[model samples]
Target: MTKKHVHSVTVSTLSDPLPSVAAKTKKTHSVWREYVKSRYLFVMLLPVIIWYAIFAYGPIYGIQLAFKEFHILDGINGSPWVGMENFKYLFFQSPDFWLVMKNTVLLSLYHIVFGFPAPIILAILFNEIRYDLFKRIAQALTYLPHFLSWVVLSGIMFIILSPTTGVVNYVMAAFGLEPIYFLGDQNYFRFTLVISAIWKEIGWGTIIYLAALVSIDTQLYEAAIMDGANRWKQTLHITLPCLLPTIAIMFIFRVGGILDAGFDQVLNLYTPGVFSVGDIIDTFVYRMGISQMQFSLTTAMGLFKNVIAFALVLLTNYLVKRSGQEGLI
Candidate 1:
């Protein structure tokens, strides 16, 4: 009887592993079957995959150039490594480092303070609008500027802000005031940048919140109304609470880009006079890497910016999560 019991225990031990093995095999089969069935979806995504592979992941090979003294004759592979010299030069050696960092952070902070709320306010207003036709027209107009390239926008702005023959100057003349050089004046330039950025992207940004607003349960608003709540009360209590998760996620993303003041906008609009207020990490990198051919320095700067951006994103996500909100980690 003891021998029979031992044999049964042995049988049970062997059979336990059999079910696990079968389960793993079944999971693998299911995964492969799904992949086969959705091959067309993957086919549709081929261009995006190929684009990122070539343009994004493919460039990862050159990242080592940041640590090396790259020469045209020596080439990337033949370049001699300098370790952290390039990074040290970029951060400590360059006199423009602190000034450029200040400009970048200030502009980004301005955008966060003013530009971030513009879209939310616009979205809220649009949601409250009773006139569908006016809402559609206003949305279309706001969205138009975003499609225009910064180069084109800069030209339009130059014409509009011209001290001599601009409509803005004409308005100032009518008001018996001096015609201000909006683009060239250091005092007004940053304000122009912030306002233009807000105007350009406000509509596109609103689309997200508008979608969020749509997803809100109408029954909640109905109950609020039944309980003597006005539109303001309903929006404050119900709409805002429901939108918090989306707002938290978007805010985290914005915080991640705190160092990326609008590169294209500043590049097109800025001159030597405005460089103090306008030059940012991206523009700095462009001048160093493209114009001066300081490959290692520019690459190091790029890496530094990315590292800070990543760290900010992680920190912001952690904070948001701790506040019991969904974060875009």
Candidate 2:
């Protein structure tokens, strides 16, 4: 074949490859541009990311202590490795572990049973109230306790439950009954924890449901009324239907956190006498890590709690997804 014909043939083959290469280059540049835009937003988030990385994620390295001897002198890095020893101690050697765990679980369960539905009822009640001023007042009153530090809340409980100058004792005296030390009694301590938790945070819980209730179309309620449905029927047929998904999502979160067991409240409210009933994982950690300075043991307990919570989140999410519902993706 002639040299020109060979050259033309070579150019024809080369032309197609040049277009493909140009398209690939354009795609790479486009991706790089988009990545730059995303990086700008990521840069804006850097401060919080760094803070959490330093403080929050940094402590995650301490989780290794659960597997190590964790000498205070050696710190986390130089600590001697002792695989599963801390966990073994926690389960077998520790005297109060089960008792504390039982109390924590029971308290959390009671909160779920009695306290879980309390906010839903309160939301419905608030929704039904005709007077916006009264509704606002009730909402504010309920949420007020959530702001109070556990230290302050415990003081309030102490006053109310005290044998002397306590309103409760005063009422018991009027009824000719002996005064009871509610805070001091082991039997009452768990009850007090659950009830106080409900009282403090139930209003805050109601807020989300209230927001969901607000999102629900008023026309649905009006249509129910026009269809000769009563108030209760309207709630059953319309209000509840709209609230179910929200309730489910919230319930999953509650269940996922079942093992958490209200550390601050229990720690503040508990005394030596009622420690049997009120002590929990968080309090136990404080006792071991702070009061006792058994850092390794405390680390083990914390690691256990986190591992269980992680598993629960995964399981609950799976079940929710299997049920064909949207959950924490």
**lDDT, residue 218, model 2:** 90
**lDDT scores of the candidates, listed in order:** 0.92, 0.89
Q: Which ten residues in a row have the lowest lDDT in candidate 2?
A: 186-195
Local accuracy of candidate 1 as per-residue lDDT tens digits, 1-329? 69999999999998999999999999999999999999999999999999999999999898999999999898999999999999888778898888889999999999999999888889989999999999999999988988999999999999998999999999999999999988888888999999989988999999999999999999999999999999999989998999899999999999999999999999999888888888888899899889999999988888889899999999999999999998875
What is the TM-score (0 to 1) of candidate 1?
0.94
Candidate 1 lDDT score at position 319 = 98
Q: Listing every candidate in turn, what is its Cα RMSD in Å to the true structure after a full C-alpha superposition?
A: 1.8, 3.9
Candidate 2, residues 1-329, lDDT tens digits: the string is 99999999999998989999999999999999998979978898999999999999888877888899978887889989999988998899889899888988898899999999999999999999999899899999999998998999999999998988899899999999998888889877777888888899989989899999999999988888899999999999998889988887887898889888888888888889998888888888887889988898988898898888888888988888788777887
The local distance difference test score of model 1 is: 0.92
Model 2 residue runs over 4 Å out of place are: 1-44
TM-score of each: 0.94, 0.87
How big is the positional error of residue 127 in model 2, measured in Å on the Cα after superposition?
1.0
Which predicted model would earn the best lDDT? 1
Model 2 scores what on Cα lDDT? 0.89
